[model samples]
Target chain A: MNAEAAQPYRLVVVSGGTSDPSSTRMLADRIADRVASLAEARDEKVAVSVIDLRELANEIATALVSQLMGPKMTRAIELLGAADAIVASAPVYKAAPSGLFSSFFHVLDNDLLIAKPVVLAATAGTARHALVVDEQMRSLFAYLRTMTVPTSVFAATEDWNSRELGERIDRAAVELLLLVESGFAEKVRTESWKSYQHEYGSAGGTELDIDLSTDLMRLATGGSAAPRRKP
Target chain B: MQFGVFSVSDITRDPVSGTTPSEAERIDAIVKIAVKAEEVGLDVFAIGEHHNPPFFSSSPTTLLAHIAALTERLIVTTATTLITTNDPVRLAEEYAMLQHLSKGRMDLMLGRGNTAPVYPWFGQDIRQGLPLALENYNLLHRLWREDVVDWEGEFRTPLQGFTSTPRPLDDTPPFVWHGSIRTPEIAEQAAFYGNGFFANHIFWPSSHSKRLIDFYRRRFEHYGHGTQAQAVVGLGGQAYIAKRSQDAVKEFRPYFDEAPVYGNGPSMEEFTKGTPLTVGSPQEVIDKTLTFQETFGDYQRQLFLLDHAGMPLGMVLDQLELLGGEVVPVLRKELAARRDPGAAEAPTHASLVAAKYGDAPARQPRPNANRGDNVTGGSPYQDGDAQAEYPSLG
Candidate 1:
């Protein structure tokens, strides 16, 4: 039996780098592994898929723009959409993410990221461009309406000294796992709210503990925990 | 078996007497060269997209769409599709439409691009290039995979309940090859998605190209796409071929001296020795290219740069015929026979799209329900308040 049966979460790591023993990939793997462990602690089986964008770099543009979606791209996009929470890492290039990473994103439509929670990470040669996750990545995700985890991790060349990289990876893993745990916990509460919606109309009084329609309506709008007063 | 041609679309002076081809003539030459490439039975034909001067293919999709209509089996690709400058939303919809029109003979090479001036020409800042490529591609990937999308990102306006259409024929998207001569990030991006890596191995040595592709292949398997051998690989080359080795060298030397990219660079022999550029007979070019396989490993496609330096149309046509008829067949068989069973074949538009799904139309099943854009005429949603909510942006 899988752990966290009461509430399940899917963890996806999207890594963009072209080295076998890559720091960014190690970061992505650690993030995924940590999230899965947290989910397991709660009796939930965390499903994970790591997508390496380099392997599909060639057809990205045509596949995205073409009227006929290719099979490989379709499968990749499906995996992206099914994730409950995501940890995305890319090596910095020309002061931001690589063209290939962005090309993969450019090929996808906007609807795939609605209300998704993402933890962003970046690897760069120097600390001068470490803020790319915030300056560039934040701006991009903001447009997609994805709820980015407030904390972003940026690692420069100096951050990794063999031993330090392992520790940093561990730290990032913990951070990502915490984010996933919180995200899934929120999902469970929402599910419960949906179940309770049917019970709302039965109450003759307006003193119900939960107004399900209002909660759902709030979620559909900005997906914030706060209730929205309809105009 | 690795033979491909790239069109730079430059109107250069004919070095001997100092006369240049008109832009129109250069563009016309592009078409003729592609036709010749097909006739020569090359593996692929790639046309670059450039908005600035000295280059004519601004709209690659438009040109490729035309190329698809003209040719039967040539694997048409973009030498460089600016991943940083273009919007992913429109990029997705437009390509989907093109896929239907082309019947699967389309793929693209993504690059951040070289001309920094072109960035502002398209209302983008070159400073934000890396971020733009990252965010925009994330959204584009989703558009292709998901039936409907609601996204918001930094680079473009938010998409609310959006679905890019027409859908890819058979719900399969084209294969992607990340073309890069320098950046390791591009290679990483290709690996991240299990896509192909094309080290435009034109100017560089086999050693440099090897490192970049090897980097990509390693990450590809590390991310669990497949083994390193299954990673799709392509490369670009430049060559001048003739019947005899000395004759080829003597003829191409003048053109090489006058070449814009290499004009001030090393001598012809020195340059060709280090790079993939070969000035030799058909057999010599074959020998040089075949040796690349041992260095780069089994690659899928090998595209060559043939039509440059104002080489006469008649002479260029002759080179293609010699390359296609005399050399390609032998190399193709040799490469195929040597490839391991564990290796994955090159993924072209027709083959990959067909293998994944099928040859089909590039239209969505229900175009009306979520006709987000390009739904102005004959849309059922045109009735009443629905139109107000989703105005016909067309």
Candidate 2:
């Protein structure tokens, strides 16, 4: 079935920094490289797709208002959809994730991130906002129902030079690699897909059971019967 | 194969003229567009139901009923009657009355209306939009089929022995098409009930439409309606046609660029290339629309968004003339030529009545004059036709 070509893991990196060479994307790239190395060490062929939010700033804002994604933006969303693990790093602005970064995710299908393993990382100008990675990004991913690794990498301008930042990156990358190999995201979608609530009409992933006892189906058929099975 | 136009009735300023039509003028124009659809030899005219500003079609049945009266052969319908906010009992009564008035030239598409605020305005929760649609449609489906129905549901008040008035024409409920931009479960609901599944094929790319319609078609087969080819499917298309492709684009680009729905997102060329939207010559529209049949596999209905984005009434009529005259006739002949013989035709009042009765005399339910008995017993109809009636159903 062409199994070799289908990488065992797809690690997608979402960099939310507006600046081209910002520390946020650097933090994301460092973690992504570590995750790739760790997956290779474990003999897992992981393909990575990086989506830079800076490139999609206008498209994201337009999609927020227009509800339609242009081709480039749509492809980026598709990559996120196919990812087993995500390295999501956002620059903290006003003690929260960048609006553009959050807007990009807001435009995505709600069920797209469910059960996806994410390595949350954030870069701030000061150490006081370092906790924003967990406080903001983790909770945001939590709302998306994505599983975040315990070790969230937070890099401030000063902390970028510290040994703790590199260790945290390695720790988060190792956790994501473990998760991607576990295949929990695909497993849950394949197994318990109907348990989640999709954005009512977003055409998420699974066909739901229409109860036979529901007044319409009962009236349509004149009695309660078994739910229609998926073919 | 049925071809027609569905209007969102958006009251947008004409980008070229820098003028906007008044609500009254726009409503008048919407009716004119429907009449023009008929004159162009189209099969259907569906209007969307919207409850907000800049969009005028608040009561689609009312407008559709008027269109039904004005036109002879055109089958009038809702692009989607909101299944979420509207009361199921009211839906049953109003649509049935419209059915009688239109003399059976009516059917409808159901959707969980997209607007978020209308939900709260109607005393419903936006969070429970899907459930509201599920439960409300459940009740509405029963009220039309069963004359006296004791119904209980989560969304609204339970009814004990409630009879929706002016029972469906010939006791046949209007046919329904479940219109979904994305929901596979709604597609499942359509498949489970053997109704039509319509994809709004304009906004999204063809791949999106293909995925959703393909799932619906597969499930329609699973539920034993027929083979996948025989599933009743409808697709929404948007076109701005002229004799020459360049002229069409030249005229439509400004409107497309200023379009409230999808403007400012993708370029007109890119949007048209990615989605079912074709702003080109009649020949271009024909070739592009024909690919939809190839992609989605012989769908039953093809409705276009012809009147949105403030295209003037004369221009809309001209496009319809081009569509109905040049494109649809060719499409009808071509699609019909390649149509799967086993595929179901689009449902209509006549077809549904025929399906309900094969060469057998159709029922004409005549209620007895009520004796102060509070309710008529046994069968309310004097003719008492229970031969095809469902038995002991609850």
Candidate 3:
């Protein structure tokens, strides 16, 4: 058996929906379910964990203002850090993703989601926000350096009942499954994590490597900025 | 352990009184507060450096010098002198002058000031803050120790043959504590030089400070300063004390609600729980503080943020009374008992002088007669190396 068949992939679903029975969360759950079923069909397992952003609203706001991560926020970060793949869903508001969705990612360490496989999905009251997923949200995942699937899922009130949305979800789920099976995130993290810029405690406080060979580190050690000029 | 108060030097309006103290009034009030710190048997009084309004201490040394002359035992220092914006040459000269005026009762903490606008006002870029701070401090380090420095650095003009005059009091550079919230480079810089690492532990959780402190300690040991247990560390905390916990909470709530930085974000109870803020009785404050030692191992200094958030002078004085009378005494005794045998002591000028010059007299730099050229020819001071050479312009 291959490495993917021997161990379960940890898939984390982040829903930025505020209501109890949020359609945004429903879209994410649908995508997550599809991913798990697809993995199981290949004799692979997926452990799905949901991070309901509404539950962490206060923590997110507190973190943005004070840089103090509440327990719930810390737990969410822990979930994201270990996630092999992610299903990030947000509610579209004012031609953009919800402020809560954007703010949650804003407080995260830049290096936390690097090289992770992600499936971008969004829900809105009207079908006009269908482009919110690829147009607005994809750039955010790109900035985080996540490998987003070629197919993105978007569900408006009308599309929720349509067959096309289901097809899109399946296409995205297969893409995510293949990426996870490839172990791309793990390979990048283990092999090339140092190629990315990282602060001292970035990557959910796990990026603790200190490179003492840089010009800044040299200056930090009482050496001049230009190494060649030093006698 | 050493206990003291450090002010951000904010001239914030009193939320209860609904009145802001003018810069003149706040300036006078800080001097009184520093004097009161000594009167209440506190060890250190540090003021922050700010170049903007709503804060008065643009020149910390000027205020600290007067405070030092007023109080005998109190050590006047900075919450942080700006290492990013200020010229390192001026810092070396001005602080050396402060060290002289205070008669060896001063030390300063260095930090990169976070205000973005303040950087451009001083001909600096905020993007270059870390390198600027690191490079500036490297120059300042040599300026104080070496009588005539032949230095070149990235951020500032190269010094061909420059002397930061009024040489350090007793020829011993004042002890420096590098204060940082999250930057490990600052901690590494401190460790590489065997300087003290201070964590401004007021805003964040203990776990965050613990990570940096742990890194600093490990790196301090790696640099062979001493064992991890012997690394000099300082922590900043926030507290408000009354006889009753409820009363303390009630009194500090309004100020805590409207205070700068963290105000309006989290409730007082949440903040006190999440951070090192302790709004309770003196015993409760002492218990919370003792946990810092448990969390960070043996630390040297613990400075409290008691006077900020527009707390009236009388209220701040009352807080100090409780702190000096009930809290710090017990904390001192407890921390002393629990201190690791290998832990370093809180740095003081006298101790630094003693370390630099055992039983011998400390060197007092006297300048040679001027050559009427604006630059000292070979060595600036009479006792410096006479054979030292500098390239001539002619």
Candidate 3 wrong stretches, greater than 4 Å: A228-231, B386-388, B392-394
Interface RMSD of each: 20.6, 5.0, 1.2
In terms of lDDT, the best-performing candidate is 3
Give lDDT tens digits, candidate 1, residues B61-114: 887777778888787888878888888877788777777788877777887877
The lowest-lDDT stretch of 10 consecutive residues in candidate 3 chain B is: B385-394
A best-first ranking of the candidates according to their lDDT comes to: 3, 2, 1
Segments in model 2 whose C-alpha atoms lie over 4 Å from true places: A1-9, A18-22, A35-48, A93-95, A114-117, A124-129, A145-147, A156-231, B120-128, B155-163, B370-377, B385-394
Q: Write the per-residue lDDT of candidate 3 for residues B141-245, one digit (tens) a residue.
A: 988888778877777787877887878999999999999988888999999999999999988889888998999999999999899998999999999999999
TM-score of chain A of each: 0.69, 0.86, 0.96
Best by TM-score: 3
Summed over model 1, clashes come to: 87
Candidate 1 chain B has its poorest 10 consecutive residues by lDDT at: B379-388
By TM-score, rank the candidates, best first.
3, 2, 1
